[model samples]
Target chain A: MNVSRRYFMILVPAAAVAWESVLAGTPEDSPNYKMQDHWWGMLIDTPKCIGCGNCVRACEAENDVPEGFFRTWVERYHVTDENMENPEVISPEGGKHGFPAAKEDEGKYFFVPKMCNHCADSPCTQVCPVGATFVSPDGVVLIDQSYCLGCAYCVQACPYGCRYINPEKHSAEKCTLCYHRITKGLTTACCENCPTGARQLVDLKNPKDPIHAFLKTHSVQVLKPQMATGAKAFYNELDGSVR
Target chain B: MAIFKDTGHLFRFAALFVVGTTSIFVLRAIVTPKSFGQYGHYRGAALKDLADRPVKYAGHQACEVCHTDIVTTKTAGKHAGVNCEACHGPLAKHADDPSNTPAKLDTAVLCVKCHAASAAKPKGFPQVQADDHSGGLACDTCHKPHDPAIAAGGAK
Candidate 1:
């Protein structure tokens, strides 16, 4: 009787603790997912993208992103033959409603999707005074809104113009590569919603990931190789005129 | 003895300062999230918050369950990898109740999203000068949305 009572006492508390953990909701619930085992990146096939703006809309809906601020955006670049270096770029409302029909057929026009590069040596992380912004084990650059100072140093430091101080949260916000989804073994909202398979989520550490083969075969380039931020977002068929 | 007597108040103040600092440290340690430092500098709790946010997208598989015929045809076509939500928009509501039918897509604007001609696209990609391709006719008028090759010979 005494032994049974002791077991019951211990087991009851243990069961309650287990239930509490379940209620708390774990983000990384995939049994096989290990953060260190993967390095997340993206391949943006510029040629494949049609500027449908599905990605932008999906991102806003998924993240509840506020108006006038964008975590990810699309830019329509019009490069004229006469001036290749100076391309006319516009992203009216961050291309959420697609783009206006081409006014002049003479220029070379294309859409470029932009987001956080998640740089290996990210300047944004370096400049953060409180270390609130950091690169996760899976190579995602994330910001802790609770700890962020809202100084905008990281905003200024980012060469890609991805970071913004979220108006509502008053914290430095940018693309997390959808860490929550990626960790849970799902693709990012933007990648999931892209009509064409233009934006692909790549796991660099995984040998089976298609990115390895794609990188080897394709002449891919980062947005600014000169900055040498070790930007993970690779663009395929990037035009020389695109800034 | 004389020096000790004179600095006795200083010793008491030093003791109080150490005790106060220690209490603050203990409180901070207790309040901080357990996994805060596990990844890097950012609070790991934020990840859980983000993951818990309600999913807005219904995903491709959910649509495939009900629309088996469409899925079958689409899988064999050029848009095999494209999710139904890409064009239909978020179908969480539709999936929950069939009564909430998704809106009919405008075929002309939908096709032009990818087929619009541009020098930026690779020469090999299937692009058409929007104005030149079928004039004012919708893309689906000539080509099937499910399977474009069905009407491959010419405009039907």
Candidate 2:
């Protein structure tokens, strides 16, 4: 058999094309295809939040959040006057409950629940050296424990101050939006537990969800939007004084 | 002599080619081996595929048939939704022997299978070990697993 140079050239390109196809299609072959639909995010209406800390308790009970480390926290803002910069100032202890009586000299008090922002451009994700912290295609930021090296860069770089270095696992961990639960068609424990309906999970891509409609009707903005991380969590009627 | 030499060369080339191809095939098989276990094949099955046939329970209602009251109590309560099979292991043997009492199923140990103890779930609320469950407080004493009601104060 006379092997032609033309045929050899053709064969090489064909093999390369075949390998590329396999690589491109590898993820589709996975069993967990429904993972694509999951864009785990939350919306908080600061105005609606009663600061009852029901969400905090619910999350703790449901998910088993530890004593020192909280999966979700609330910050209380005390704006004295409409213009004055000096407020009462009592952002204490993650505010598992409402602020302790608004520092005795209360004017205007409100609470903001804080958790993993699950930023589109997460600084925590970018800083992770081992590629453990990653944003999924649906926009939920996450940590893959199987791949984590426990570098703690994710813990340090999180602007929202959510990620923590888990001492027991020796790995950086944070609110994964209850990925195991969410993947199973269940809502996040925090969202499920909120009695006041202050917290709402919404698909940003879906126009039909109340979150999108609310964002349109009322002026809603993300915390530290100037940071430009494109954080999915939005606060409705955010207190300008708190910023 | 030339003819013999040519034939010998052809024979060596043929042997090398056969050995090389066989070796490559064997190496590839070893490197990218398929799953061998029976469970491995079913991993990709959809819910409908899994539930196509009634589960093999051997015509025995098992726990429910014997413990109607417990089943009724559990079902009416919070744990009513939880499948009995989730806690109780396969029941074919248990069904066969009514006299053979089941060893006390450790509720704490069983709950841990779903809720792994992690930083997020630190207390491991449902999983009560012997020390954790002692002091007139078995897991069932405080928590009626079948029906975990949100009590007036709170469900502990």
Candidate 3:
């Protein structure tokens, strides 16, 4: 059928908007992106992290995270002489830029990068009344923002304090483990931007991924093992004082 | 089949039950998404919703295609492993469109960002107190921004 220019012009703008919404709700094919073959996790060598805040800044830019809230941030653990088990932790401005200079030379200091643990046994997913927050087959805990009630149940349920209600979206949001990039076989924005290779995205199922060798040799600890949320974000050289 | 003696009232009650249950089934079919339980309790299509988002940083390889010379220089220097986006910021548009050149960088502010001294940083990560170190001079004045150790030994 032949179409007139007037109808064609009207259809073009409408189609563009409609197409994006359709794609957002539907499943699109990503070649070679197998869910069963991989289980996503992260590795952090805290000793190697320079506290440059590059990872934090990169995550915000890549994910378009709102200011005054973070999808990921760095905390400076100021271990003072007074207390060792409980270090004074501060994350100034979500540690988007480097932290302030240290005032005392008494005790040691270290930086810990924080994001969603993407736990296997996730409390956030369990408490979500709407089933909005859930664990993907690839083992990354994600939120279906479209289905989310914005009740902040997951935010309160999370032991790590990772989830937050996005001020703009008015939806509960946290790290998707950079799902958009990782599913395409690309490393996360934070891992890509880290200068010292301090943070690495690990695929637990991949036999040749080198994290297996490292895990075998190194002593790795997940935050708050006592809570037993089965958090997957692993930290090496984790101080006994860090919480 | 003939257990109930009051057949009229029982038939009406059975029909009401069937209609109520059928209506609920129809409502569920209408309200539910197509790919809701394809994987698990969550909507499986949410994975695609997530994966469909644009990859902002084009990765370091994207920079290597156009700027081979710069990549080579960086590879030879202390900044070898650092991503081009680490300093230049996300330039996915610039990489896609040749005409969309990124803005010029300021070595003054950029250099001190990572190099500034802090107790949390590694003890020997080539940090310096910016005020005492720079002496009101741009970092590039004495050191090459890419290959920092080239000009006058950027490190102590």
Candidate 4:
């Protein structure tokens, strides 16, 4: 076939773009898994947690998280009986090392495991100048790292203080709730390593999930509910004093 | 001929508008990723990028398939809920390659990492002072890791 120079240039570029999509092939680890069928979230049972720091350690190893940062961390809250509102909380080294014995054998002490709340009305998504951060179809908020501007807008917008800029990559990083693992019919690193059944990755759409039943019976609360971010990380026996 | 000359400026402005709009559309079509806006506002392929990324921790169920003896012991113990990878670290590679065994971890140090007395821990949960619990002896010396309450000899 005879082609003019103008037509040839257009044809080559068009073919190049088409070829890239063909190579992409929509490859997924679990090809049969459907995102629409699931709405992902997490459950934290505070009473069950032993504060062993297993979840924190497992997340770092699983995600290749840099040192002095955390994807998930345990915070110890020591609330006095008299002044419940004035609780002393500490998360040294992102709770990687278990805390020392309590100096004050006071009113009540417990560990609160914290991670990205994966809000439905996420401020992080709203503030992204490039819209690199967005909500996934399965109700999980995710970041397209390649498109991220590393402006740290998401880091600042997050009320839970979950998001942080990866020092080396300089991109906003937070808990994905282990999207890579969950899509492949696996639980998160944090939930999997939790020895006491303190954490469980919940599929809100799945009727069989125990979360639905647990929610019915328990008083569930998200951190900073006043912000009204629709945070999906549910906490059972959440102390009113927790900040 | 008189009408054409009078409306020449208007025609020129219309032509520029057409050309400018067409070029903008072409530029967007060229630069935009094929998968953009396929799922949401972001690139659709990002979802696949995450879903396809390799995992390090082979769930405890994977280990149970091969090491039934060890897993059986663990399942019947205080640490039954603890996944194998929690203590073993990421062993997805080892699960595939039998030759690539995980390094022998020091039980003394490993046990203390979790069991050491922590103020933050729940009261019902077990805690110990490493020095007081053992006179510099490995935890596994007396307490079987799989079943901590049981002695190494299968005696409680």
Candidate 5:
């Protein structure tokens, strides 16, 4: 009886510790989502954007993004004929409340909405020491908050200024391409709210997706091609002045 | 006898330390998730958690169910493919209750959201300088929200 009691004392706590670890490791449930089947991307038609700021607002509401930080934002660029290369760009409050009336009529103005490019050869993923940030099988870059060490390496690596350390979570955060919604056969909040159909969610693997035809026809270019990040956000009618 | 006595305590301490370390490793082995590194470095369970979140936007079909007349008129116009909530805002509340009327949209501001002139826009696409076009008149004065073609012609 004494031997059995001693064994029980030691074994019970060990078993309990093991069980707790198992619970901690429990993953969120996703059923019937095959990662190999989809390669997701976005096509932003710069000409179609009117800069209403609906996409920015929708992204914040959907993601619970904090103020002064942006998962997505709209930049209004005004380029004059005299200085085409030096365009004036501004995004007041991340363009959540829409833009004010243009100040100068001499310049040509257009709005460009920016977000995570979800690069295939992402610099952010490469710099994460813990692999907290990684590209998913469907071409979306995502962060695991649980595993993140709150290091800012990913933030520095992003050339487009997409990432920020989430103030509340203390983790590096950026656009997931609405991973939660897209995996379940729904479009992104930004795409859904865009009035002009300026933003479109594309599935590259799906041969029937209209992006195939659009790519064949339109002169689409990714942001910062010099970075060679394999960025998937295709911009149609991107102005030469846009950085 | 003196050496044996001192060494016995040291052996006991070493055994305890090894046992404690072994137990921790055993626990970790049992608790670690099986599908953690299946795709890349991220936990596979995160995908499921994200998928389970409630959808916010009420899609085009939901609006079409009740507002058939507006849908018919819109379908005949250029903005047919545009979802109703693009202008109406999120309809989760309005969809649940018919009495909750959505706020009226300002035509001047709303129309320019897509129609403002920009050199980056295609040459053929309809665009106007908001201040110059119609001399600061509201867009609705010249074009109807639902059927602009009929409003412009004033016949048929």
Candidate 6:
């Protein structure tokens, strides 16, 4: 007996629909589905940040971040096209006082907080031979220190140079987006303490989050978008000339 | 011939078991929360509400109500972005009793929890080895949280 190709095609889709319906109705014993597509991210408004470096201190205090190392750091961008050769980006050793004095030029200056961009297409995650580095369902990039061979592949693969191997822990380390705090339902240490609310942790899935609305209303751009790692961290008011 | 067939079946079973055991080990590595990798799974208060649903935490604003001066100084200083709760353990107890002894954000103890001394120090920051910095030095000994200036005030 020959079966019609149309009938077989219809049967496959129908069976798939039935299977999906059954799975949908069945409550998952292990709720791993809730962990999907979570990308914890930040929106830094340079115009509002005021160069106070409060976020830096707050991050240190919150996560007990050590001296001489940073989970979250700030970068001060100075644009001087008039003397293009002399134009430079100055990140005065510590970000505590924000940016150092910009030279007397018609150029512009702004403070940009830098950390793991937590790209969705994260190069750090891709280069981990031991699978120590990964992106969370919520979109934060993380390192599993125990599994980390400390091979430093993640460090090299990262174009932004965010990853570093901690010699003390004998493992790789990077900004965690305050995972311990954020998981406990607290705002990220940096976001909560931002006096001017210049920095914000946003849920891309939540339409109510002011960040979603802001992105929709404004033309915010991600850094190094050309790398096409699809960074979750977005910035507003950065001059196109700065890049 | 029957004995040979039986031996072959046993060999296949053993191979399957070995593969299964190896797979379980690999899966464990993938699923385990190793180091800061688990940070990506940070489930903020709102998301936690969707999970087990009982945990609660206070925002910095709640602390600022009573810590007005501390909060003011913190906001105006470099430490403004640092939350009162970050240094202080938890606020619920303090919120419940405003007179409760609060935690201090001072010292290398605060810094060491995260910024552990690397075998090699980065730039101007001093080496914070487990033993060297493990002793009496507080974070404030060399650096000020509110100001970038190295504190001559020393660790209190």
- Best candidate, lDDT-wise? 3
**Candidate 1 chain B minimal-lDDT segment of 10 residues:** B147-156
* Residue-by-residue lDDT tens digits, candidate 1, A63-105: 7788988999999888877759788898989988877766546
- For model 1, which pairs clash? none
Q: Between candidates 1 and 4, which one is better according to TM-score? A: 4
What are the TM-scores, per candidate, against the unseen true structure?
Answer: 0.81, 0.55, 0.89, 0.89, 0.77, 0.60
- Residues A199-233 of candidate 5 have per-residue lDDT tens digits of 99999999999999999998999999999999999
Q: Is candidate 2 or candidate 3 better by DockQ?
A: 3
Q: What lDDT score is found at residue A130 in candidate 6?
A: 64
Which model scores highest in DockQ? 4
Residue B8 CA displacement from its true place in model 6, Å: 15
**Backbone clashes in model 6:** 19
Query: How high is the TM-score of chain B in model 1?
Result: 0.80
Order the candidates by DockQ, highest first: 4, 3, 1, 5, 6, 2
**Model 5 lDDT on a 0 to 1 scale:** 0.82
* Chain B TM, per prediction: 0.80, 0.43, 0.89, 0.91, 0.73, 0.44
Clashes of each: 0, 5, 0, 0, 3, 19
The segments of candidate 6 whose C-alpha lies over 4 angstroms from its true place after superposition are A1-34, A82-86, A101-105, A241-243, B1-58, B61-156
lDDT of 6 by residue, B1-156 (tens): 465654877889999999999999999788754333333432122223233322123677677777777765566655555566545544556677678766566655554543443322123333345456546656565565554234534223
Error of 5 at A138 (Å): 1.6
Lowest-lDDT window of 10 residues in candidate 2 chain B? B36-45
Clashes of 4: 0
Of candidate 6 chain A, the 10-residue stretch with the lowest lDDT total is: A26-35
> Model 3: per-residue lDDT, tens digit, A1-243?
887999999999999999988876634487688798899999999988888899999999999898888888999998876658668898998889888887558789989998899999999999988778899999999999899989998899999999999887899999998999998877899998998888999999999999999988999999999989888899998988887
- DockQ for each model: 0.44, 0.03, 0.52, 0.54, 0.33, 0.09
Q: Model 2: iRMSD?
A: 14.6
In order, the first chain's TM-score in every candidate is: 0.86, 0.81, 0.86, 0.87, 0.86, 0.80
Q: Evaluate chain B of model 4: give its TM-score.
A: 0.91
Candidate 2 residue spans exceeding 4 A from truth: A1-33, A89-93, A97-106, B1-156
Shares of reference contacts reproduced by the candidates, in order, are 0.44, 0.00, 0.72, 0.78, 0.42, 0.11
